[model samples]
Every structure is written in structure tokens, then in C-alpha cells.
Target: MRFYLQACLLTTLLGLYLCISEDSTNQDEKLPTIGVSVLIRNKAHSLPYFFTYLVNLSYPKDRMYIWIHSDFNEDNSIEIIEAWAEEYKSQYNGMYITTNNSSGPLHSGEQHYVKWIPEHFNHVIKLRQQALDFARKQWADYLFMVDADVFLTNPDTLELLLGKKLTVVAPMLLSDGLYSNFWCGMTENYYYLRTDEYKPIREREKTGCFAVPMVHTAVLINLKRTVTDKLTYTHTNLQSYDGPVDDIIIFALSAKWNGVELYVCNDYVYGYVQVPMEENDGIQSDVEQLVNVKLEAISKGTPLFWDPFFSKFVDYPPPSKYGLDEIYMINLARRTTRRELMEQSFKELAMDVKLVEGVDGRTLDFTNLGALGVTLMPNYEDPYHKRPMKTGEIGCFLSHYYIWQEVVEKGYQRVLVLEDDIHFTPYFRIKILLLLSELEDLDWELVYIGRKIMTDDEEMVSRYTSRPGYTYWTLGYILNQSGAQKLINAKPLEKMLPVDEFLPIMFNEHPNDTWKSYFPNRDLKALSAAPLLVHPTHYTGQEGYVSDTEDSIVLDGSAFVDGRIVIDHATSRIIGRINSEL
Candidate 1:
């Protein structure tokens, strides 16, 4: 009897130990491995958003791994990333994959330097392969490759990806006003439309914007394919070339070679928000005119389309006029002499004033590319002083950077960003000022006339979802104080589209949670704001070349210097030096 009791107790203890051991293993494998790789160039400002996004994803902590690769040696981002990874390792298993010093070396003037200098293109391809290798080593199930700025909005994004066995899940293409290529056409009687004229506007050429549903960012694929197929193919294909495969054309071509079926889901998995502008009179005018026309032209005296979810249009009481004087107009060709046609229009539109004269390098620090020059007017002593010429477009990044960091510190209501070349009609100014007065409480960051020409089709442009006329164009967009500050506050990434492309709408494939910017030019009825016109037809006669010629630059690969615009050997443009003061 004693022996029997001892045996039973030993068996029970052994069973308990086995159960505990199994539980421990299960705990270790908490989340499924989801391999993700991103590129973090010199611009580290975009880092915090990406990190914050990773933190918010609804997935198991131990299951995911992220690799960030940068080119600049020991770039300033090293410390920031090291600190983040150290702090978040317990919760999120993040890794830094750098190629700055790890790769092979080449002889410099005096010392040996790393040879593997991955710029935008080669960097993308390298990172993709690196991700696959890491995944294979980690035995990760899948890989998600995207730009560092991309953020997941739907926490269930991981849940959606779980158990999916696809080669590519192409993210939906959302447009920022800059990249909108599709031209929309409005019917002749677009405003206060009658039933007979409500046909779909057609006869416009389709641009490439909406055609390719697949952008490289937010690409999810099986890990095995990424390693054996994708990586191997890239090496074989681009073996002779030492460039990157980051461009959209390369992405599409690569997917074709790999025979990957692309899937595009519109679940707002990622949100691309940007800083807002204060001068979005185009959108405001459209919304007002559209709503007012609809309400007034109602034969049955019906209220505006009042769907709570979609319909945000509401009528308010008339405004009390303050009798504010009209503001001065700006012209782009003011400094440089323009063609006869542009000059005539300029005079007719009260834009006869020329751009301010060029300033010295000491005053206008164009070399840094971050320092902007502004000349304040005496009468306009208010905050809206400091009118800069091409700086509004070329040096916008710097302008906004300064306004956010300094101007916001002192209580400023708004920041008006104007381009010297833009011409405004009297009606345009009146309607815009009125709209601004009306929507005073609107928490908007960006306001601009989306002037990407409307074609015959009502579906004017692709990439961007629109309401009506004067869609958001990058021509002359404005950002508010908060929007400015946010851009200043956030870390910027080196690899990015122009400022126009980086705006909220264009920033990501998905929409953002906190919509920081808006183009309120939805009202087709109100034609008062500046008419969004086509691109300038003429270039200044500075380049007096009757025929094309070729020019080239020689580089020692020692130090970098910026002189007259130098087109690299890669670009499609014929290499040449036109006469230019720069």
C-alpha cells in the first residue's frame, strides 16, 4: 500500500510539470512573427510618428520585428533609435538594421570609407532583401515592407493579416493635391443643376495617378517568397547596376517578375495626415456655393442632403461686415520678366507689382536649403508680413519650419503663405475673405485652391477624394500655426516626396485619424475665389537656347558641391547647362 501511494504521487507531480512547461513555451510564442523593414534617411523627423504607430498596432508583442536602415555614418538618428528600441524591446521586439559602416569599403582621398552607399533606390532594394533574410533567420511567417512615415490606424490591421497567404496586398492609393494627375470635368450647368444636365462628365485623358493601385509602401507578402524569389530576382536583375529599385515603376515591374497577385483593401489601415493651412478659400467657397445653390434651387423647398454621416453642410445667419480693405495681390513673374500673354493677364488682374529683388547669401541662406529669406512690409505690420517670392514653393519646408518653431511661441492666430506668381480676381478675393469670416471656428491646417485642371469627366482627379470644383492643388496651399508647429515638432525623414506630396492626404496610402488639413473648395456655384489656372506656359528667357546642347559635371567623390543645376546621368533629361545665374 505504501509503494502504491508513492507511485501515484510521483505520476501526478510529473503531469503538473509537463503542463507548466507547455504553458511557458506558449507564452514565449505570444505573437506571430510579422517582419517589417523601413528606411530612415538623414531626415529623422518622421521617426516618432512611425514609432508611435508601431506602439498602437493591435498585435502580439513578441511576434513582430522591425528593421530600420540608414546610410549616413552614425547619423544623428542612431541615438534616438537606440533609446527607442531599448525602451520598447520588452513590449515590442524592434531592431535597427544599418548599412553605414557594416558594408564593404572604398578608398577615399586619404582614408578608406565604406563603399556601400545606398541612396533612395539601392537602399529600398537592399532593405527589402535584408528584411527577408532577417525573417528567414527568425522564421517569421510574413513580411510587411513600407516607408517609415506609414502608420496603421485600424488596430485590427494585424488581425486582418493573420492567416492570410498572399504574395502582395497593395495599399489603396490616396492623393495629396500635389500628385493628383486625373483631370475631372464639370458639366456646363454644374451649379444649380437641373435633372436633364446631370449626366456624368466624360472626355478627359486618364493620368497615371489612379491607374496603379499598388504603391510600395504597405506591401505585405509571404516571407519565403521575399527571400528566395524577390531577393534573388533583384540581385540577378540589377547585378550590373548599383542603384535602387524604389521608384513606382520598379515596384510594379518587380511584382510582375515575381508573379505576385496584388490586393487593394480600403479599410483605412494606414492614415497619412499632414499639417493644415489657413488659406483654404477654394474649398470653403465650393462648399458654401454648393450648399447654398442646392438649398436655394430646391423646387420642393427641401433641406440640404442631411445624412448625418456624410452631409456636413449647414446654413448659418448672415454675417456683420467689418468693411475690411482689399489685400494686395502677388505675382510670380514680378522679379523675372515673363512672356507677353502672362504680362497682359498680370496687369488686368491687379498683379502688376514685381517680385522683391534678389538678396545676398548672407540675407537669403539658400545654401542650407533650410534657411528662408522674408521681407516684411511696413503697412502690413500684422502677423501676415514677410512676403517671400519662390520661397513659398521652393523653400516652403524651411518657411513652415521657422513659423512653427518661433511664430507659434508668441500668440499668433494664423500664418498666410502666398506665392508671388498667383493672380486673383476681385470676386476671388471677396468670396475667399467671406468664407474665411464664416468658417472662423473650423480647426483647419491647410487651405488652398486645388487647381489641377478639371477635365470633361466629373471624376476630375484621381488619388484624392474630392467634393467639387477647385480641388486641392499644391500651387499655393497654406498651413495654420498648429500645422506649422507640428511639422516643426515631428522628426522628418530624408526620403520623401516634395512638400506637396508629404501633405496629409498624400503622405500615406490611408487616411489619418486627426485630419490636420482640408481643401474646402467644394462649392462650384461660387466662382469668386481665384480661378485655379493651368501651369505657366512660358519659361523666363534666361535660357536663350534656340536649340538643345549638352553639358556635364566631373565629381571626385571627395566633397559635395552645388553649382548650376546638375542633372545626374540617371535622369531622362538630356544633360545640359542652360544659362542661369545660380
Candidate 2:
């Protein structure tokens, strides 16, 4: 069995290791078939979320089978399952459901629930054993037992677990509080024991797959393991051992008795499980509680993106820029075409934008630059043959400088600056909103949404960052007042470089050490996103590609006709033809 463990190279590694994951991910091969077994009681409200995430798994559906056992549900859980199965049953390799009609599930706060604990455990154990037997009967390579309330946002979760090749393992799932799926230790009497290693692993201070005594909620059983056949969910299987009536506890005990070590991988965020709210918790409804849990997850830097199906219940991108204060677009006066394209794009998304008139380098001379307090620094070297700074470079620098001046003038706290030549990612508005939630409390200044990295070794400061690394681009970034003021006070005009060139220098990422000495503070706090959300709409050699700075080229020269920017029918026809090919 090829474990294929290489694909999960930790994201904390440099870009060199990233290449390994990239290469492994592109392989064309079928993954091992696995069975997903789930038990549903009175979890009607949570079923849709679980099914949505299940269907959205990156694993090949045809290679995955599902076994669902429903019983003791009072909230139309059986009806919901039938409806879903009717639509999606054929998609999986096989899907089976066993129904047990019995009394309704009792909430934790109910007076009789404590008295019925043993009965509840009996039903759970029977269902779990049935699931295990069903997987083995179908010759499944593995079985993933997940509770209805366990929310998994990561699509690659199944594959990540399979990569470990451990006997029995579970991905660490977070609850609203510090609670997780895995326990580091158990007491002599087979109860909870808070071990010294629990906190570090739970908080992810120490990462990687760690051997743990027990894991529950959502666990993966390696059916291929030789000793797995001896594992049992029924606690009575072991006569001498006396543990609680919990199915999971018994399963753990059974696995331990058979010399199967359980492990939990906390290498990254998968998703979370709902921590049931008490009656006096003031939660209005189950849906409201789910929303609260999701919001908390977002604020804590755990990415909780869901499939587009969930968007039907909630708005994807906010109607307004929820996290940003303002958005500014820098456009040259002569480059009216790019500005028009940008306006059209933003209009489609209903985004509010302010157009800042850019300084036209074509219309500038040496005296005009000096008048504007612009001068090249002593040690500035353009990698391209150490070429002299062009008037276009000066204009580009001054354009951003003026925007920084505006950021400082209005005291805008969170500002997004955009260049006219860039195109937004398909879900730019939605992704930016989600990304901003992660940065809400971070002491950030400039974060690039689009950039060209100069260094091979980039540090991901957060889930989406490459800080303290040299990158080249001024396409799109979020800026703050302090950073704006710092850039203004840096005397950039006194020693000018291209806006793209200066950002790396200010962030202390300039490859050349000489540029760093001149501006030793290097404290602008700039970083960039990985797999940048924005990209240039046009690049060199593309038909419509044009650069105002270099080559003095203009792709679209036609000005307004009948109060509308117009392109010649011939060019339009050619563009239409080109787009059709795409």
C-alpha cells in the first residue's frame, strides 16, 4: 500500500516543499475506496450542513461509499434523509441506510436523559457495530465515522487522514471553546485525564500526528490494519474491562486491548463541531447557534468556507465592503480604456470605488519631476541592466505616493488600493471578505492581494500571507493609516523608485542590501497573499496587453463616442473570437 504521505507536506515549510505537494496533487490515480458511516438521531437541523460538506469532499465520490443509520429522531430526520438520498444516492459507489423507529432523542438538559444513558449507549454501539461490519463486508479500505454535529470545512480532510496510514486516527476538530476531538490521556478507571501534552497538541503549538490514547466525535478506522477486525464498539466484548457505556470509549478500549494506537493530526484546520448550548444560553434557535459558531471560527483565523450551496441561506460577499474602510483605484489620464474596463467590472459586482487620477509620465519632463520632489536614490539599481529610472517609473511612484497622502489625509483605517490593469478572482468580493475576517485583529499595514514574488523562500505569516519576503507588484493591496503615513514620511520623493520596487525595499525584502541601509527602519509591515486573488488582465505578448511605463504602448486608442467608450467593430470582433476560444 502506497500511503502517499508526501502530499501533506506542512504548509509552514518554504516554497521548496510546497512544490512537492503541488507535484503530488497533480497525480492521475484513483485513491483507496473508503466508507463514511454516520448516525443521525434528532439532528435534522445539522444534517443539511453535514451532507453539504460531505458532497463537497474533494475525494472521488464514486470511490467513496456511505452507510447511514437513523434512529430515535423526532425532527423529520428520516424524511430529510430520504429526500437527500433520492437526489444523490446514485453519485456514490454505494449508499445504504438502516432505520430504527424508536422513542425520540433526549436533550442533555432533560431530566430522564441521565437515566436513559445506558440505553442511548446501547443503541449507538449497535449502530456503530453495524456500520463497521457493513464497511468490512463491502471490503472498504477505511471507514470514517463522523457525528452529525461535526462540521468539516476542509475538503481534503479524508485524503489528509489517508496519507498518514495510521491504524486509527482522527483529525483534530475544534469546538466553540478549547474542546477538541482527541484526548491525550485516560485515567486508571478509564475516564478523562488531562495530560500535560493535551493543551499543546489541541492548541497546535506542537504539530504533526501525535499518538493519543483515545479520539472520538469524528474518527478514521484503517480497515486495512490487521488488528482492526478485532476492534469492537460493544464494550461487553471485553469481559474483565469495565468502562463507561459510551460507544466511543468502548471502541477506544477495544482498540487499545488489540494493540492499536490511536492518533490525532492537528497539522491544520479541518472544521469544527457544535458545542451544544444550554437552555439558559440565550440562543434563539439551532440555526442561530450554528451561525454563532461559524462567526467565532472565522474570527479565530480558522477558515470556514463552505460550498456555494450554503450561499442560498446567507449572502456570500457582503453588500458593502464589510472589513475595508475605502477602495481607491489609480488610473492614468491617458489610459482611459483600462479605467473603463475596471469600471465595468466593478459595476457588475456593485462595488464602491474611488478613482484617483494618476500622474502621466508621458506628459512629464526632468524639471517637472524635480518640482514634485522626486529624485533617484544613490544605490538604486534596476535589475534590467541597471537601467536608469524612466519617467513612467517616477509617475507610478508618485501616483501611489499621492494615494498614500489621501489615506493619511482622511485617516482611513483600512484602505484597499487597486491598479487599473488587474482582473479580480471569480469570487474576489467573497474571498476578500472572508480573508479580512482573519486579519481583523492583526497588526497589519499592507497585504498584497496580487504580487510577483522575487524570493523562492516565502514565509506564510498566517493562513494567507508571505511576509518578510521580496515580491513585486502594485496591483492590489490593503493599507492602513499608520503605514500610509510612514510611506509619506519615508521621503520616497527624495529618493524615488517604482511603487512596486519601493514596497519590497520598505518591507526589508529588497535582495540588494544597499537599498536596505538607505531606509534602515524597514518597518512598513507589508506582506502578500499566496495564490494571489488578483492578476494582471494583460501581460506582455497577449494581444490586448499594454504597458504605459515600458514600450509606451497603448492597446486601445479610441476615445469616447456618443458619451461611451467605444472599440472599433473589427477589434471587437477579434476580441470576441479570442474569448470564444477561451
Give the whole-model CA lDDT for all candidates, comma-separated.
0.40, 0.74
The numbered model that scores best in TM-score is: 2
Give the number of the best model, judged by lDDT.
2
Once fitted onto the true fold, the runs of candidate 1 whose alpha carbons sit more than 4 angstroms away are: 1-31, 73-76, 99-120, 173-175, 178-213, 224-251, 273-582
Model 1 lDDT-worst window of ten: 547-556
Estimate the overall C-alpha local distance difference test score of candidate 1. Answer: 0.40
Question: How do the residues 1-582 of candidate 2 rate in per-residue lDDT, one tens digit apiece?
Answer: 234444445433557677888889988766789999998866666677788888878999999988898866556778777767877899999989877666555634444432445557777788899899989999999999998878888889999999888989999987645678888889998888988899988778889999888898899998987799999888767878777888878998998888999999999788788765554433224544455455444434343454454444334223355557888889998777777767655653457888999878676554344456655665454677455455577677888888898888988998989898886654455577767887775777888998876777776877766574777778899898989988887887876667887888887878777666767678888767665878877667875677777753222222212111122454432110112223
Error of 2 at 498 (Å): 32
